[model samples]
Target: MSGTGTATGTPTGNESNLESAMQLMIQTFHKYSGNEGDKYTLSRGELKEMLTQELGNYLGNPQDKDAVDKVMGDLDANNDGEVDFTEFIILVGALTVACNDFFQEYHNDDKNDKKGK
Candidate 1:
């Protein structure tokens, strides 16, 4: 990468960049999932399954049973056992931040490696 804030040779705040990247991911998920209807939603099981399958190594098996249960408990709003758009957005926002932090660490490690070389 060129740099953190100016990676593309343009100034951008970390939060703004993060939001933009997340919006793209959200739009892509909506399109790929065919969530065209206003009432479209995903149940806890479906959400966890999708996260595990799509996110793969990022999610890392949910740590344990309690972790999985806690996540479902938090995201399943309305007591309907499903996550709506709002819940989905919140869930994805947290996940995106986690993924971004991982990438930042990897980038820093790579930079250190280059310097060592």
Candidate 2:
């Protein structure tokens, strides 16, 4: 990695991949949060849009609004009807953990299969 922190500089223009991902997380939240009421938080519509556009593959298309509503209800945390950065981070952390668990399990299963052959 270069001293300027450009291991492979992304459009986010940060230090490393981890740094870039962190920056992207902040950037993404602000991108959607600013579209509506608080500007520092995400209204339901903004949340739905963010999830649909940013997490469509992981969260699914959310063909019914119920999923969005449920997510909003879960992430609101303070009953404010909006998702703040902290609440959003919780969601991201949770999803990350889930993905990690899945990948680890998949890898283990694959390894076991290989051993069986």
Candidate 3:
């Protein structure tokens, strides 16, 4: 998919991987934000649904109300009881960082194994 338009103009598909990722993040946020309440924010139910449908593999047991509540408490930065795009992005950014760390560690382990063999 192509990058999204900035203050300048529509971005072409030839944009960098980071640009495409930014567009995808925007798209994903919108995909789940506007269901029950504010069009730009996610209500608790909407957040739960998004978590279960989009990040089930990573988040696990999204059906667990306690887990969902904990996430909601943590992500509601402004204490508004809802998750805005900025808050949602924080969650995504954190997960991406975690995944990167895991991959780096796994790669290092593989390299060490190869060296030992």
Instruction: Give lDDT for model 2.
Output: 0.85
Q: What digit string (tens of lDDT, one per residue) describes model 3 on residues 2-111?
A: 34456432467677878767777777788888688898999999999999999999898999999999999999999999999999999998989999999999999999
lDDT of model 2, residue 101: 99
In model 2, which regions exceed 4 Å deviation?
Answer: 1-14
Return the clash pairs for model 1, or none. none
The stretch of ten residues in a row with the least summed lDDT in candidate 3 is 1-10
Clashes of 3: 0
What's the residue-level lDDT of 9 in candidate 1? Answer: 31
1-117, model 2: which lDDT tens digit per residue?
342344333353536777667768988999999987999999999999999989888887655599999899988889999999999999999989999999999999999999999
Error of 2 at 78 (Å): 0.3
Model 1 alpha-carbon miss at residue 77, Å: 5.1
Of 2 and 3, which scores higher on TM-score?
Answer: 2
In model 1, where do residues sit more than 4 Å from their true spots? 1-39, 62-65, 77-80
TM-scores, in order shown? 0.55, 0.87, 0.86
Comparing 2 and 3 by lDDT, which wins? 3
Q: After best superposition, candidate 1 residue 12: deviation in angstroms?
A: 29
User: What is the Å distance of residue 111 in model 1 from its true position?
Assistant: 1.0
